[model samples]
Target: MPRTRPLPSNDYARRVAGQFISISETRLNTSPPRRLHLNVNILHSGFVPSAWRLPDADPRAFIDVAHYVRVAQIAEAAKFDAVFLADNASIADQIDFRPITALEPTVLLAAIAAATTHIGVIGTASTSYNEPYNIARRFATLDHVSGGRAGWNAVTTADLGSARNFGRDTVPVHAERYARAAEFTSLVKALWDSWEDDALVGDKAAGRFIDTSKVHPVAHRGEWFSVAGALNLPRSTQGHPVLIQAGGSADGRELAARHAEAVFSAAQSFDESAAYARDLKSRAAAYGRGPEAIRVLPGLTTIIGATEAEALRRRDELVDLIPWSYSLNRLAGTLGVAADTLKLDERLPDDLPLPGGGNGNHTFFHATLAQARTHGYTARQLIRALAGGGGHRVVVGTPEQIADDIEQWFKGGAADGFNLMPDALPDGLQDFVDGVVPILRQRGIFRSEYEGRTLRDHFGLQRPVSPHASADSGLTVNA
Candidate 1:
């Protein structure tokens, strides 16, 4: 076969062998080893509702940019993955006693992004109240400004108080909200994917700034939104801002399966958290997505001290600071029972029913009940267990003990990671970073230094391809 095409030579065999090894390496690189992820929740004061009353706590810190910037600096120094800011349209907490979710999330996060270099900035936005186009542009702008360290926590406004703020007398029905959310989220993603990856053509000599042909209108007319134009801004550095979701209702689960890249969940027990992970991943597979596509991060509040005894003492102090009337009222609100009916020393009512007619926080109501039932905890005990956060699980112990619990949850498949909410800010978080993070690092489950420059990189997520581009590249536009 000394013709035009000769027989394979030794050189050809060597090249083939190199290519096979290259392919294997590529696969290995794409699937990074599983590790623990952490994001700190920067609620006013801290996770403990009365943390502002602590000696070093600032009364006006909720509105102070300096306080947030200081926390961001600490988190960045520790190589934390992100800092999350949760929002609600109306006052969700007791304003007179402690700060509420006061600042607009995206706006506040914009300031945080300026002060920090690498930590991811995430904020909540309600799909039920926002226009898809506006949200798409806002998050895209944030991604671009932050150099791709931006995430959006998608939620439907959960209460009638929020509805009243928007001029509606009643909250939208549960099904209606989810239906709108699914469509709204889909439309926002479509708008993000409207422009092709090659759409930006900056040719200074020729004076052609963009390739108009590569840009297309989304033209979405869905049940919830009617968006006609392409996004004014170009695609951000990360392609699209990372999508984060939080909800526990059945409809909420389905929506997360279809769209979320990360989920913030609230489960009271290890078994419950693991079950939720399984169910969500299975649903995602049914939607033609891989099980590894989404990361499940359940909320974990910690009260850490030098010793377990001191940790319990600190928790007792915080619990004492909270007026019993407020705890009783808050628990009553979650259980949808009368405040007078709930005695602080007694266990939750055995015959408790789900909130009447879906007019409350469905996820946390169920979670709170489940925890109470599982532990047979009294109202006072449950109040202390939650550390003033309505349904988030609380862990009170020394730094070593806290690290052990986190490891158990991560290795046991109870969580992909945790959204850590320390009992107090700056100081509380500082203790975890200085104490607990070292243990995680020594165990080889958390990163000692950031591996990538973007939020998706930090999460080991792939940059999405333009849906309008060729199918051979792996992305397809369904809308």
Candidate 2:
């Protein structure tokens, strides 16, 4: 007969109760604190159009892998949450004056991932141009290779240049692009969930390698995509690479609420940013997600100097380097108006309708318009305030001042953090890391050391569990 297990004694129960009370006391003493997340945008030379023309800047840095690697190394040393790479399929910018987004994002980010261990690698891929399967696979592979430090920024390309590159003479309408994007994003998430966490058995003794019943075929048939089955590879770490979105339209916000784990926002004022955040979180709640499910990181451009006057001088110097014609043309492009229409000393046109008749970039248009209207700035003053950039908020100050602005935004519920675009790369980023990061650390809002390895962990997001594992149902494997 099997021996009977002994029941717990009264003394044992009292000991257990004592241990529980101790743990309860500890929990009472400690509460979960809000942390600030920071990511750096490696925009070729930097945010400034004339950044490459700096005496120490490299003209070829836009295409140089070494230059990107150096920047990633600096960000890693500073313990940044991620390094982001933006993409454009065509020559959208005036390449004659400045560098364009030349390198493909995922590819470049993979190289950056190889060079750094802790920093997350996020890359933009337009749903308008690419198939969902390819994107799902590419990011999954990146996650596997980088030890789960990959993120996909789903975006819709609106420019005619990108449309023509994809064999379309006319750009798709705004609604259609977003509709397709919604389907594309859903299908990608399904594909990522096709394989169960325990699907790979690898049992050498029994010669049973995989639990075929555990792998699922998504069979997703949507208006935009029709995927037959499961992905070719196993489910990646962190389940799926973090989904990030950057759009400010109503449709964009809805898409973000449903799919995006993080959003890169563009707002010109604190009130605007706070309102945006509140609206976005409410939308997420409507989708049955918690308030903490999404992170709002507004785009911020910083021009750092030892003093306020010096920072202004630096801003002027960089702005001066950009030709007036280039600035006018760029602003015109963003506003969807002819360069001749914008007078340097005059305010923007009163009836500046949506760019491309309401199909252009809504985020920048609204942000730039808000800045102009709020401050009553002329075209020249607007350009100066933007620090030669188009839409993002620009902060020019010393390290302490920069820290103060960041702390205010973070605590005021305006932003979870910022997607920082320094005035220049390498040196500019180095200044922030060396000067500003210490101040942030001292405030206890930022991390001194990385708490985890994966990008999701860095962002304080939970690792998504596969549906197959949760449902415990039969799965059909595709050949």
Candidate 3:
């Protein structure tokens, strides 16, 4: 049995208890109310590279199971929809200065799921390097272990470091990666749907264990892979773990439109984000999915304080802690230029082209460029604005001010919700849960308590029925 951690202190519990409003009381409008979906991205110590240097931070939190459990507990207490984890198969970061994502996401998430209930656990798994059958089985197990609160953030790896680790001399071309991703995702879904919902029958009296007639083989053969399917497990509680995709290129958008239930977007401004949301939904509609088929959750970093000045001070302190050399190199990687190409006092190079000849991470490249070009920021200024990160929008202010910004983005159709990456972990997440959550609750846009158990329920998504659940499909489970 997984050991359970205690909830917040009694004082905090009472305070949150007082804020709870029943669903009946909040339903005033004739139209359906749009509640906010917030997921905390537990990025090691936190989003900032210097976060591990904080006095209260555990330098090894990136690999500490207890650290993630604590963060998930806080998010669940605050009624956040989920806790998200990003993964890398290689040493993708400046590891000398910060902790890299060292643990596999599903493994870490399983530990987190054991320690908490209610909060969804979403993890990234790259289609670039994984077999479809393995990816499907891994997340299915997570969903079952988490009681249907698992989400897979499907992505394609683009970094050369990841390629070399996979025994490849070069990164796959942009189109090929996305194409493989699309097929990879489809095959995974098919495997998940292999067993009909009622296929299992534990009737010892009748000496029957399963209805073999109901199990179907996917028998998928595509350009990138060939798979004989019918996963060994039954469909999970949510039918399939919530499918998520995070990419900004044209190919990425098409994949999301066809398959993704939620997107972790990296748009820097309201206009850009809203436009992206609109375009993505339009594409989804073209694929015969409804407007609500996908949720656009933009990445947001928050630095909170009692006052705006205090918040700015906090932001400055964290940003200043980052070594300029590290920041410059990281920025250069995103912009596809040499570190020396960027001058602290000068704007980005006027003739910047897409990274890796248009094959690098297009999401961050465009988002970071938009922020710099929009404000005409020098390299130094841009780093400060980004809170020493790459592309996500950072907001530094009091809880109210931060709430106001979130409100604008949520109500303006710029986002469905936010994938939060705080400046530091446990402490930073605690700050938001204690300070920002109450305000969001009072405003009637956020949940005071969870209404359902599954991740699909939290996102207000329907449990999907297996398309292969036919009485006489003339298919059998693969050996």
Query: Which pairs of residues collide in model 2?
Result: none
Worst 10 residues of 2 by lDDT: 1-10
Give the TM-score of each candidate.
0.92, 0.92, 0.92
Instruction: Tell how far residue 457 is off in model 3, in angstroms.
Output: 0.4
Report, for every candidate in turn, its global Cα lDDT versus the true structure.
0.84, 0.87, 0.87
Model 3 lDDT tens row, 1-479 = 22212223433322322222122123322335899999999998999899999998888788889999999998998889999999989998898898999989999999999888789999999999999999999999898888889999999999999999999999999999998999999999899888766566555566766778768999988898999988988766666799999999999999999999999999899999999999999999998887878999999999999999999999999999999999999999999899998999899999799999998999999999999999999999999999999999999999999999999999999999999999999888888888898898889899978988878878877566567645343222211
Candidate 2: where are CA atoms >4 Å away? 1-31, 470-479
Report how far off residue 277 is in candidate 3 (Å): 0.6
lDDT tens digits by residue: candidate 2, 1-479 = 11112213423323433443344345335645888999999999999999999999989999999999999989988899999999999999988899999999888888888888888999999999999999999999888878789999999999999999999999999999999999999999888888766666665556766678768999888888889969887765566799999999999999999989999999988899999999999999898887878999999999999999999999999999999999989898888899999999999999799999999999999999899999999999999999878899999999999999999999999999999999999889998999899999999999988977879878877666666653322222211
Clashing residue pairs, backbone N/CA/C < 3 A, model 3:
none
Residue 429, candidate 1: how far off, in angstroms?
Answer: 0.4
Give a tens-digit lDDT track for model 1, residues 1-479.
00111213323423433443344346446776798989999987898888999999998999998898899889889898899999988887667788877889888888999888889999899998989999999998888888889999999986778899999998888889889999989988888888766566565556766778768898887776788979997766567899999999999999999999999999999999999999999999999997678999999999998999999999989989988888888889888889999988989878777675775667899889988888889999889888866999999998899899999999999898999888999889999999899999998899989987778878877676566765332333322
Pairing residues by index, what is the TM-score of model 3? Answer: 0.92
Query: lDDT of model 2 at residue 142?
Result: 88
* Candidate 1 vs 2: which has more lDDT: 2
